[model samples]
Target: MSGGPGPGRWLTDRLSTLLVVRMALERTGAPRTAVAGALRWMSPAGWAAAAAGLPATVAGRHLGWAELVVAGAALLAVLAAALVFTVGRQPYGVDLRLSSARVVVGERAVGAVVVRNTAARPVLPARVELPVGTAEVAFPLPGLPRGGEHEEVFAIPTARRAVIPVGPVRSVRGDPLGLVRRAVSWTQVHELYVHPRTVGLASGAAGLLHDLEGRPSSDITASDLSFHALREYIAGDDRRHVHWRSSARTGTLMVRQFEETRRSQVVVALSRHEADYGDPAELELAVSAAASLGLESFLEEKDLTALTTHEVLPAVSRGALLDALTRLETAGGPRGFVAMARAVSRDLPHASLVVLVCGSGVPVRDLRAAGAVLPAGLRAVAVRAHVQDEGVASVGGLTVVTVAELDRLPRLLRRAVR
Candidate 1:
């Protein structure tokens, strides 16, 4: 440092170099970013052609070879032509509408896409892409004049229950060789719910002592619908509940002492762990069974709580319940149904009845364990979704049934209750 320059001079020199580099980058930053974006649009073949053509063109001019120059020039011309297809900005207005946002598993999800030209001039024909779940469907859109509209109706296949994403409809522009491509999305994504099939249950199929008035519990209350024993009137007791006949007989003011009445609240827990099902289709059967039970409770205006092994589903309304079921997915690993039952017992201590939905492959020991974890005296039913062996049996303080079909669910429940 002493031979070349002082320490201060060396520091100044380093600062000057950094400043020069920063100025250079600031001047070229936009152009570099633009070039990088353009490179992203180039396909593999286009990149290869450019890679070879640039070198060949420079070598040909230095070596005085005309053939090399002509070959490189032709290759570059093809690229330039492909680039023309992607040069313009897309001028389009699109609206995606679904015939019905929700449908059953076997039903079709019908939708229509209306596209209009928003520019003053005619727009060229393009390919429109619609992403449906993991797959994409393409439609050929004809050229439209200014202010013209085009409508295309399509149906999505719904072979099973699921929430399928059906859009973010995008228009694609590319050359025949696919050297350069551009796409612009026109609409937001929409969800199509394919709900599980459900079967109606008998009025008294499931719940705790099904009574239209209300089921009576051990806890006594001052005023309720169900009639209980009368007690000496408390200081704050309402005068309307004064039992005149009881008071006259007992020679004292006695108010109606009533048991706490509560409406039937049902809890349905569907086991989604992979180990519970021998075949993947068995999980579907389990879901249908659970859905049927929950939907029945929902339609009857019974308080319902539906859950899977991993998460809880909406049970507020019929549509919300079905929509949540459509989005349910199975989990992997060695988890058992006992966790779900324990959760029901913990979270919904006042639940009147608990329905355990599981596949046939679930061990009987696990089912017994699941029932054991519930609160004492809580009514429990285990619905084992079986492929063929369908019947009803009794476990320790728990009723167990095997259902082979959705139509058999109501009958199975009736049998379990009996």
Candidate 2:
């Protein structure tokens, strides 16, 4: 005898059909109770009896009242349980919080989220979806207690400076039977900032500036209140500095020689105009050269200033100068080299050393135009590379040094300063 159908396969097929019908009803926003009621009356027995009624011989006796009633009652009980579970499940919500809204580049930052069950009963959220930039992390909140909170820490990458916005964490709650799921969004926003990276060159490279020009090679030049060195009194020596105490003790006139101290002012200007090579690498090289020169000058105890075309005032301190260089790496505008040079010249101290870091092929006319306006006694050095012109010569009152490679910058700078 051939069996009509396997019980397991029959149940699976019926479940699939019921699922399809439920989805169709849901799409049309039909009442779930009405759909459930219709499904309860559509039992296997009803289908079988309907088929039997189609045959001519069994048309009159195919279906009986008892079997239809029993099968219909059983389906109604199953559907009643499903409906109770679906409507009785609790709802959940999530909220995210951040410690700080703004942060500096290269600094660590933190973010936390709290999950709460707003419904009267507890809910076991099966999964949670978070929009965490380029990647999604799904959390399993299987036993989320009512009004409970969960916290997590994520590392923020700050290789560059920018503003970042972080989420409205979404909570996904599933029914106990896993037959239905619901999602809810929370109102939560966070902002993070990454501060710039700074290098400490004050103490690391302090000794590299010994024996430089324009300053006496003594660290304690300013501490001359104490006796420094005894020397023969020469004409025009200060009368107050006759050293009478020392002269009387030694039976001879003596004079005190104080340490010599002088201040050297240095002005560093960067050409912000687009390079001839049409590449950013050359611009970066120019910025790095400017920074290196400023730091070196400061290390030598010289008052250093960094100027760009867009700004009227130049940066004075080493840190401020470096920040200015960072800004120049991203700045774009028309060629204002002559304007910047003239501006710097007006404000620069007399007898200062002016260093111009520019790309090659800059109109010699522009350099000559600015040089004509420079203050008298100011020594100017122009650091230019072959990036624009193949053959170049020295400009008026300026020493022209060309760089064919980036590695030669340090050497070129050393020569220019000397």
Candidate 3:
């Protein structure tokens, strides 16, 4: 969100820059393979020792012969160990396992890596580097005898909601001299989803249901099952549906009228376009809103359908919904929210309700227009994920709620029923 775009895109862009640098090194005959990959870097101690030894080796000849001999020997020893460390084969059969792949904000999670020595002889101590998002952690491994395994546990950060890439663990090997280092990646990449915090809307379920089901709109016609009221019989009216009491009293026929009713289904249309979200805070708020509202709808057992700029998320169960929401990142889609609205209008014309969770950059007029495009009698509610002093209001004839955060959504939802 800060550098280029979303986290994934920013990571890709950063890695591209690193790749360009590595490619230049490879062009100059640097090794790109694991055996002699250029991923290695000299530690501070290595650089300092080399710099000191070079001058001592040069000036010691004129100053003192003993100084010259000692400095040259130390330099040779350091270089010899560095070369040996670079040539040494890394420990094999390393495996990384995580406690869980999905969690909420402020929760704790752990990752364990098992280092195995499959060589015939004892494997020397080595270093392990694990990638977590844009950062890496390096820890030391104890020497392991052949066929022995050692496991190390590390804490994963869950201070915020994000999809943290956990692994592709790399093993580092270097001598005590800290001269040349070699790293070989052994494990595959795994992602952890730190979902945003959400509040349960269990108490507000009735309000949501009433809005979805209770209506006296003329836009909806009576189906065979849902009865409304009786009115004077019109031409070609079915006599079988005529009311005998009203006809006998007034000498006029009255037919039974009904209001159309279908199985209650709610569509949650979330705008995930990066432009729509505007900023990181707005993006997070928008996602939280979607999650909370969708969960409440699902808890109420209404047929819930979730739509994003990318596609419709599976709402079959809570697990599926949370997983889908956790993976929802901002994107710059080719089409905007209007396109998504059109899609919903055309495909879900019979949906009893539609909720649009928009971001900061989205205009209220545009959302109102989007809601206006829905089929007749299909109520539309717009929720803006932005900082606001007022909780709810009407905009452009469409009901809109401006929420500063996700926790206020339930109150506004309940109030909407009034």
Candidate 4:
């Protein structure tokens, strides 16, 4: 009286079978989707032919129709022939190597793909496809005998700063009718970082001070090297810091107080909001300017923290900083300079100098608000990227400078700091 299996039970059984098949495939050095992807090898035309011809052939035989059967048989035969094109085994060993993984914008990125035949027999001519960023490139690979190889060298033009994905070399086989198609990936994807072009800035530019002993602040501490004053010793005060001579003179326990000294740290925050810039090129200029500042700070042996709209970038080394910058993109939302400044103030409260890099579209009011959020006694400077000659001005205690090119950054920064 029970049905063969309930719908839920049938689905569960099918899922269990799929999981077992996936595990088996994975254990054999094949991906779990190998079978599923194989099923999708049929092109749209092949699917359409199968969908119509199979039904037509079955119904034609049942209804005793000669023309329908003939048409269906011909369609099925075409599909079968197309399937033969994808039946052969592909014995390919692919190696994708790049000349360099990092380069400045407008430089050429070179790479080569080498394909070798691993099987004892010869490999038929085929097409190799490589996906670079959003585009796919194809190279014709000639037939190769056993132990034979072929190499294809390519160059990628880097017109703008970005992190471009290079490839996963894949071999594609398809029938001329576009009925059946098969692709097998042979190499993993690689990243090419087109870094922003940064100009050389003089050491200690932007008034960045380098001091191993640290700069003195207004905050008073009981255990620092910079002496500030002496106060009556509290019960919890360290006895080592107590001035015994002064205590004897005043007939009371006196402890020495010192001004807190912090190592010079520069925080460079580049705005990544799309609306903050008048044009796309402005943002690029701003990025280059920020990179210059960060590099200069590193060269001068100072602590540096680089930031953008949403996240903090690694500033441990110049290469790491530039790599992070290459991957940066503008935010679609309203997040801008003000948000980055607030982050610097909150997360990097001890920063001595805060450089806000943005485009000319940012309003003066926003710059003032950004400077206002920073901690007191911190030097705040804003660089507004533009397409015209550079200029400098002061707005609401914030030093605002407009830079049109990378070479003008140093002069603009010098003027702002002075």
Candidate with best lDDT: 4
Query: lDDT by residue for model 2 over 1-418, one digit each (tens)?
Result: 8887899999999999999998897786757675664444333544444344334223323464555555555544444443444344446556676777555456777776666667666665456766655556567766656666566556656555445657767765443443334455665655554423333333322333443354543443323544468876777777677889989999888888666555666777877777422466556556656666677777677776677665533556765565445545434566776777787777764536777767754677877776767776567766665554333346776666666554565555455545
Q: Per-residue CA lDDT of candidate 1, range 3-117, in tens?
A: 8788999999999999999999999999999888777878998888788888888888999999999888888888889889888877999999999888898987789999999
Question: What C-alpha lDDT does candidate 4 achieve relative to the native structure?
Answer: 0.87
Worst ten in a row by lDDT for model 1: 204-213
Clashing pairs in 3: 221-260, 222-258
Cand. 2 Cα-lDDT? 0.60
Looking at model 2, report the run of 10 residues with the lowest lDDT sum.
198-207
Say which candidate scores most in TM-score.
1
The regions of model 1 sitting more than 4 angstroms off are 1-33, 203-213, 229-236, 244-254
For residue 102, give model 3's deviation from the true position in Å.
0.7
lDDT of each: 0.84, 0.60, 0.78, 0.87
Predicted candidate 3, C-alpha RMSD: 13.6
Ranking by lDDT: 4, 1, 3, 2
Q: Sorted by TM-score, highest first, which candidate order results?
A: 1, 4, 3, 2
Worst 10 residues of 4 by lDDT: 204-213
Give TM per candidate: 0.89, 0.45, 0.69, 0.79
* Clash pairs, model 1 backbone: none
Which pairs clash in the backbone of model 2?
Answer: 103-193, 104-194, 104-195, 105-194, 105-195
